[model samples]
Target: MKSERERQLMEQAYAEIEKYQDLVHRDPYRLRYHLMPPVGLMNDPNGLIDWNGTYHVFYQWMPFRTGHGAKFWGHYTSPDLVHWQAEPIALAPSEWYDQNGCYSGSAIDDDGKLVLFYTGNVKDDQGNRQTYQCMAVSEDGIHFTKKGVVINLPDGYTAHFRDPKVWRKDGLWYMIIGAQSKSGDGKAVLFRSSDLCHWEHLGPIAGGNSKWLGPFGYMWECPDLFPLDGQDVLIVCPQGLQPDGMRYQNVYQSGYFVGRLDYGRAEFVHGPFEELDRGFEFYAPQTMLDRNGRRILIGWMGVPDQNEDRQPTVGHRWVHALTLPRELRLVDGKLRQTPVKELKQLRKQQVAYPNAVVANELRSWPGVEGDAIELRLDRIQLLGSMMEIHFRHAARLIYNSDEGVLTLERKSFVNGLTETRQCRLPRLRSLHVFLDTSSIELFVNDGEETFTARFFPYPDDRTMFFGAHGHLQMDIEKWEL
Candidate 1:
């Protein structure tokens, strides 16, 4: 039963919805085609599934303010993954098990009904935390009936265990959860169930305790295990990760391991962990197979404990958005992700410039500037040591051919100083850039690597400049989204 506290929270959320809608109506940094909270704050796309011919996405949402607190599962439905409509809030943190928050989880279609498996978080008077693996069911994919806690905390692990990802394989249900041991080390535990409720623990598959992976991270937050192109993939977000050169530069790290899962032994024989996104603002990515059999994934476009108050959108009463829905493919034992084809519906007023020359000076082309747009550069030959793309004078994308490194530079809101994040690539060929009002996604070389980040540019500054130290030939296309 929904409690009085939940009812009061819902009323406040609705009131803030109306107020934030009016307040952000004139906000210039609002996203045009991305999914963002209507009010307050949003993080970690959860319960992603395709049910009964429609797409459903739930996110960790706190609707009363711009900070993290008791979270509700905010809902959104899409017919083609391009157009989206906000639905009513799903799960509220009102029950005894979830008094603190309803954390991240997954969704599954069970016999024509939608079943949501999530984590219910609680903390007691002494500040001791508790967690439960819970479930809820929806017949019409709109309204849901909470099933409460189905799986409790087992021995040897602390309450940091959460974010259960469930899937059915070979007529048996399997789950993978991110967990922290009582000793405070990251782990991914495996479980199996004949029904969806009662589960049997299968022990840790790969984590800090493993011989190959020694001392990985302090804690793991969101864990997802799935089969992609004949290989098993484990996706997780590990907090308190120290930087490894260009990797793990953010406060936390989200990445995946490609391997084969031995169901008999419940072991994952895998490769080294590789980061999924090399960006400043990416975490807690979740993936699901759609009706078309495509492994589509979305990630939160903001990181935790980094630049929270520094975000300019907090003044407008909202922050954070989901990355563009990307289709994942396994090519040459590496995961390749590209923007979904349905996003093409947003393309309009296309402009193409073939074989353009970039000399020593910055140059702008006609119809090459907009806040909401898609830019593609292809078939390029670099004759210079350095090349750069200035995005509205607020952000910069630069490539140095000599070092084989591509860099993104932007002014930090905390100290008003320039900061950069970069990744090394073999060569420069093509780039696909998606620009929203407050976000940017750069897919390099047909999704060999991608950089996703949030940027705040002036409303009137819609100019883009491209330049090279020497000279080069390139083809360019821009479409207003």
Candidate 2:
């Protein structure tokens, strides 16, 4: 049931992938166990769902060049979260309504069939833009049928309205979309559908200049709303927030507000916003509930338009990846992210040190070094005010117990100068570190605080250094992942 134009463009995208197969595979910086594009640019994980015992992940892909343009919905499927297989392209910019691009949205299961909701991006010769909330369906989760536009541009909002996240609540289908008001303030709009085809607008639930917040940002992108623990969480990316002290330091910010949603009145009463990840890269996260009843999350490891020209992977016709699937737990008022237990299957070599002590001078353990591995330290008792662990001489994780601050430092992608990002931690207990070829994911104090970043270090340098102003004791374990 595919249109002629849609079928042709998807074939072209497959051909593009085949053309760069060798070049892309030969890149030294390619991820070892992460989901990356076969070629071109990738961003904003979309349509994540666990349907019929299989996990499906789709994303925004530009297949022809290492830059952003009209995107194709590239897909990957997994029986288990650790192993993945690339499937056919889900949506192409072929239909007239979506000829510009098939942008971000979510997925759902409807009567044993897989349903997808996405933004149909259209543009005219003069570069004017129009957006449509569109739908598609698949029998096998591989090929999608474009149902065309189901909803038009509503009144009082700009065409920036996109990234619809839908869920079934109280036997009704509800969707929340990121939007820009006519007055140029960001917001999240609410809608309801009885049959997933017809919809009724429920007005704005939350965002800038709404019931609670002031003018926060000009445009909000990629919104997600779901119930976690005993409360509701709304995650969104808001643009145009200037840096205030230690937070909102990125080009933009991705964070959440915990509150209660009144479905009857279409209102969301929430608390203050808190930053999601204290890292250099981590944004546009999507989540799903698996059969095991775990709320798992994944995010794009690169920010939008943040030193894209400096990315080394583009030389090989590939750039960017999605982070490892992380299990989410709402702890003490904030969400805690930890690597799913399935990732332990990637562990190969095991190295452990019991009651290891480090003091004064920098030192290296005999077998604690690799470009791709996981390091776990438990029951760490610091005898000094400060301790520093350097990774491959490329990045450093420093903790100061006296100042109650933990800092992550790495060389800048734009300039070689050292750059640092910090978050407050009452005390340091455990440090879990994952090191990939060109990236790092640091989970501190049992996921109470986490830092995720991508840094390019010397490929040959796999040594790690640990130093302390005074003696510290801890249990250490390392595994090659």
Candidate 3:
């Protein structure tokens, strides 16, 4: 038996399939299973709210087209965050105020009701952008009713004001929106609201002419602010930042800054910018408070401005997916991310390595073939100049201490595009990696820093290898997906 709302959603989904049958019917991407979207093109996560034993996540979805066009709010709900149920389209850009698209925003549970706040994007006849801060409400957590604009673009702020992340502080509601300065600098502004209907600008929280904060591109997008280990952490994905040394490698990347907030003075005292994830694919991360009072985060696994048309799964209808929710904690003044323990529910067969296994030369683990698996390598002794690990098909991951590079190479992608990123390390000792069918997450030095990537593999590429010239020792544990 299905509820009326569930049946209505089913009918709506069927109708959508019929309407966009040409574009909606495609194969799934070949990357780790966690990185590829289950159905359609998905980007930034919006309206992440945990309410009444269920979690609702809205994303930047494009329904009618295969690429990024006609942005609509796609909804998904999960009781445990591992398995998701697709719901109806929460918001469509069918109205005048949001005819162009409905951009990214946040959600909150206001006294038992789910309140969604998102940016209503509008473009005029000249193709100029107009952003509006809008509101919606849901009682059953599946359907939403728009409440029009709650805040408008203010003076001194450019038209790029979008991605409003709302939170409750003390006794009032506060929002942090990504924006650009008049001189074309990226920043995030704060706002306050006594009632959900009215709002007041509180000026910039950070990212406006700081000596240490570098020119973080033109405008920051998807601003997320939360408290971790007694310090406020701000995560923002900025555009136009050129690669300087080992930072800002992706077309667009997400990072964070740990700081203290003085709400009375409307200012944020922060530290230098730090890359959140050192992976090939990760962008526009969103965070929320779960039922256990933990701050968990999820990020889009695809980069912006990349040639995704070459993705193998384009024929399958979906493109990207959200990373597994990770709990954030501040350790020794640095943000450490770890997968929640709930993910263990998805694990089946477990293989343990009780004693240290030496791979002085290249070694292979039999039956280590699957799209989904959890691997833990402890006390890794890298005695060679370089060592490589292969997953899926031609996905090669190398940790080279001699060259100070940790590279993930995928030659099987569209047009044989192989992307690699490296960070300077004194010496590589230990590595912990998680591999899903279409995604790979590497946690180095026990979560001191991490990398997240999405890869598309060929159907027959399930073999893995550990290649090294000199002696190497490691304790490896493999678990079924």
lDDT of 1 by residue, 1-481 (tens): 4567777767778888997798866678989999999988899999999888889999999988899987889999999999999997788888898888888999998888899999999989898999999999888888777898989999989889999999999999998999998888899999999889899999888788686587889798899988899999889898888998898889999998899889888888888888888777999999999999999999999998898767999999888999999999999888998999999999999999999999998999999999999999999789989999999888899999999999999877677678888899979899999999878899999999999898877878898999899897899999999
* Model 2 weakest 10-residue run by lDDT: 305-314
Clash count for candidate 3 is: 18
Tell me the lDDT of candidate 1: 0.90
Tally clashes: model 1: 0
When sorted by TM-score, best at the front, the candidate numbers are 2, 1, 3
Candidate 2 per-residue C-alpha lDDT over 390-446 given as tens digits, one digit per residue, 9 for 90 to 100: 998889999998998999999887788999889999899999999999999999988
CA shift at 375, candidate 3, in angstroms?
Answer: 1.5
* Top-scoring candidate (lDDT): 2
lDDT measured at residue 143 in model 3 versus the true structure, 0 to 100: 80
Q: Between which residue pairs do clashes occur in model 2?
A: none
Report the error of model 3 at residue 199, Å: 0.7
